[model samples]
Target: MNQLRDPCRSAGRTERGRTRARNEDAFLDCPQHGCWAVADGMGGHRAGDVASQWVISSLAALPRQSNFDQRLKAVRHCLRILDSRLGRALPLNASAPYAIMGSTVVALLLEGNRAACIWAGDSRCYLWRGQRLYQLSRDHSLQQQLMDTQRLTRQQAQSHPAARSLTRALGGRQPLMLEVLELCTRPGDVFLLCSDGLYQGLGLDALGRALSRGAPGQVVDRLFTEVLRGPAADDLTAVVVQP
Candidate 1:
């Protein structure tokens, strides 16, 4: 079976914290299939949870294969499938439109020592290697747009009201603007995929410190502690991938 030859192995864990009314985040770790992902959903209603589940399940259903191109193609295909379903599930002018029901997806597919990443919206993917952290994906959010046009300062954008407002996401009417990243993976390298809730409260410097000090699990716990020290406003989720 293809699964037996899978070169990647991973562990995924999640927690529902003290504040949010619902857990609208999802994650997956299928090391045998070389897939790992984190999705953060938006919507006041149950639509957020629904959107997140759809993304995770769709990605999980993709075939396990050795070819990188084929694996990436499957990832895009899964996203399209989610997009179509979301469109049918949430019409534009419905009485209770699920328009707000969208999600940011960050995923990595590892084959041997090479990794491919795909992202939509603001949920981020960071690569930590040799004590340096590199943000592998750009946020597709309103704050990012403002920054691009020089309309908002970086510090201001961090606290901007629309910082959480995503410009692109899965299940929206517009086509997804997916970013693909390819990088070499090392034995001691770490990859962090997390929701805005994790980043909003913990600055990059703090995050770097945590990553430098502990294992993947410990880093996640420290991050959660930092987040809880601040005002709790949204659901938080984090997935650390290390090999």
Candidate 2:
């Protein structure tokens, strides 16, 4: 086996926000494993915080792999196992959103110069390069569906009452089908993995400026500062990574 050390640094933060009684969000910031993630537990569901914590802990517990593909497969398989367990344990009903537990996840895996973003639901992965911000993950939500299939503008799609409704997530009704995007890393690339609350509160301009700082800790601090500056009605989590 060819073992190579992952050369990356990361920092993370999570908040329950002003209105939420408990934080149902979790994060993993392990640069040694070259794995970082943000998981947002489904709001209005029972044991939301526990669901998110399970995701973070499961990923953190994965054995180190010699290569990116091995690590990526481990992540997918781990999540799939958890999803099946949650489905049988919770038996969620679409009509009763609060009766079961689930979560949305966005994970970033790095090895050498290669990186992959794997995600489900609305949690997002973003890249900051050449002074521009690019969202790497497309949300699996009704809002995104409207924009994609109906060709509606972002504003138009968001106007719908179910715009924020998740179309896919861990422990959802359907089998897990995680979306993955792989890319070659650049010398100055900055990546941000965050829950919906973080991005929904801050604009792209603010996020780009924060990531432009080029240090994981500083970028995470800036993000938290910006998001908490206004009304924060939901739990928020963020993991910032730089290589």
Candidate 3:
């Protein structure tokens, strides 16, 4: 007989940070559902927080599925519907360069030993194993495009004025293109889902050290403490999962 790994254990939190007027970030931490997500909203007065909250709320409402594939499909389906719905709600006369209401999402789904990551925009998912941390999601931003196509280093890409701009997101003028990555989880593996605010404020080394020595809750606390030590100019959110 084979031994089966236990389901995931998770913890999550969000903050307005020291500079943001409002925290336009939200998270879903459901170990029971084997689903976790972090959403970062984008927009102005229309309410970025609302958009992010809506994203997390919708994911939270998903019905439990019996298999990993079914749950993966359900999450993808939910984001697609949201993209259409949010796009339709945009003003017909909205023009270029205007801020559009939308949210960046990164979600993780776990079942037995399988895990899947679904995302749009720049929110991220990371895996921590064997004392090392690995980023599992790619950014959908101009900076990344420059790095990919022009072979520019991250520092060079950052020099571009619009490098931080998102190239894909829910409710943008163009249709959303979600990315998916599937992989098998090992026993005692740790996964982290976070908004840009959290990742940007802390380096990979800090993140790995935090994940190396604690439970989900302790790691989350360490992450927040480290980020808050800095300016934390934007809203921050993080979810840590271990199995």
Candidate 4:
């Protein structure tokens, strides 16, 4: 059996982008805790930024444990607290279209050779190796639901007007149904945790190319540069990790 390697170089950045009045994206890069995450808030100005910040803070406070199961439990605890906290801060009104204060969170927890991905809403995690990039987490969004039901192809769903609408999130009306996936790792493997905004304008191929361009720090810089050249549809955030 192969042994697991610790996370090496890592870099992350969050930008308000060209259009947004305020950035609602937040991230964590705590290698010592073996946790990294990205959160993108939604529901306009009700409390998007606050929700996103809580997502990051909650995960960051989780006890550092090597056991995957315990770590998962810790993550769950934070999410519930986030729900309760934000739920109270932003009262939900049935009549309002965007009433709940919530955010999408995607997290990567690494222990030994294994990686556990946890997520809610549409924020995502991706792996890059051998010049190919693989999206590790699936979006919990209307677009994804349409694809799952075979009502729309992946490409079609991406372009659909409702693509940005999330089907699930931390403080939404529905109980949070977080998703998790565990995977083995390699030495050269690179992982990315990002908000949907970072990917909205970036083509998948371009993203892969940027990941392959250089070291972790270089790759992060390159990704932002690429996004800057294009029209930013939302606030952008990218967290790059290597192990």
Candidate 5:
């Protein structure tokens, strides 16, 4: 990966919107460790908040290590352990059968010239570099699946009946299949990690203007302002990192 000279800045936020009784979203803003994440609990499931909290808390307690690759491995191991715990709890929840509490996760790890993004479900990662914005992660939803198979075009997926249905999530009955991407980093690059609630009504032009601003905090504020202008159907969360 190419290296750049500028130092990094970071900030994040999460809010319970107008409708939800409780916020089921969680985030990790660890600029010191170059790690950030956003997780959204499945709203229809009971105790979904518990599942989202469990994952973020685990990530927060991750052992500090100097090696970047080792840190990624540690994160993978942590999730695998979480997967086991949730699997074991399924039967117990089923008999007393707690409703299936699951969550979607998107994590960003930056180390010098290298940037790594890992995720499941619809949580997203976006990059703003050289005055342009690009999505770094893809959605793991039913509509996205249809697009992948060529059954639906990009425009078709937008209005599809299952547009918002998730196909993968942490703590689900199916085994987790984590998707990861590693790329070279550039100076003055800004990364945005957010949950579905923050982007549903957001426009690309507004996002670009905000991301091009001077500070990470202001970018987040602008995002919240734009998102809250319309109906906020769920919890909103976003973490902005500039490196």
Candidate 6:
């Protein structure tokens, strides 16, 4: 197997339009090993910001390892530990109001010339090679479930009332079903991990065009502007990694 290679990376974040109380999104930068991540918190009645912060901090603090499998295992272990901590800290009480507190995570790890990515919830990871764009993560949202049952079209799901309702997330009652992807790396490849807030306004075509035409910073700035045009429903976070 080919090894992963280090890549230059950049990241950015913003809060949504309507919600002023909290910005519940997080991201990390690990340039030394070409690792980057973006996490979006479940926003409602609970402290979603806290959940996002804990998950991001745990992933960022993972010890560096030489082996790919070891590194991946460490990442998974860290997430599990965070889940347990959150469960202990914020137990749900049926007698009380809804206490939903969890986060969506998407991360990219580069080793030698190969790359692996893991994701949970709706936060997304995408790969851009040449002119083609590939989405690496699957959403754990209710709209996705509807699509699976042929009850909603992709376009309808985008604006569904329950679009934000996630089926899985870190800190939830059940263990998160993490999605992982492995890909070959090349020098000009660009990987993006971002919250739904960033992509809800702009489609893949617009994102791909922006990435192809500008630097990472410029792309993020433009994307933020586009998202701000819509109702600010949640926090927005993005991480752009290029190799």
User: Which candidate gets the maximum TM-score versus the true structure?
Assistant: 2
Candidate 4 per-residue lDDT over residues 40-69, each given as its tens digit: 988465679888998898788776655667
Clashes of each: 0, 0, 0, 0, 3, 14
Give stretches of model 2 more than 4 Å off. 1-6, 91-98
RMSD of 2: 1.9
Q: How close is candidate 1 to the true structure, as a TM-score?
A: 0.88
Candidate 6, residue 167: CA error in Å? 0.8
User: On a 0 to 1 TM-score scale, where does candidate 5 land against the true structure?
Assistant: 0.92
User: How do the candidates rank by TM-score, highest first?
Assistant: 2, 3, 5, 4, 6, 1
lDDT of 1 at 132: 88
TM-score of each: 0.88, 0.95, 0.94, 0.91, 0.92, 0.89
Of candidate 3, the 10-residue stretch with the lowest lDDT total is 1-10
lDDT, candidate 5, 1-243, per-residue tens: 222234368889999978899999999998777789999988888677888898899999997766778778888788777766765555654456645668889998888788889998899999999999999999999888889887788789878887888888887777888889999998778999999998876887887888998688989999999999899878999999988
Worst 10 residues of 1 by lDDT: 1-10
Models sorted by lDDT, best on top: 2, 3, 5, 4, 1, 6
Candidate 1, residue 133: how far the Cα is off, in Å? 1.4
74-151 per-residue lDDT for model 2 (tens digits): 999999998887666675468775566789999999988999999998999999989999999999999999999999
Give the lowest summed-lDDT range of ten residues in model 5.
Answer: 1-10
What is the alpha-carbon lDDT of model 5 when measured against the actual structure?
Answer: 0.85
Assess candidate 1 and give its lDDT.
0.78
Instruction: Tell me which residue pairs clash in candidate 3.
Output: none
Ten-residue region with minimum lDDT total, candidate 4: 1-10
After superposition, which runs of candidate 5 have C-alpha atoms over 4 Å from their true positions? 1-7, 90-98
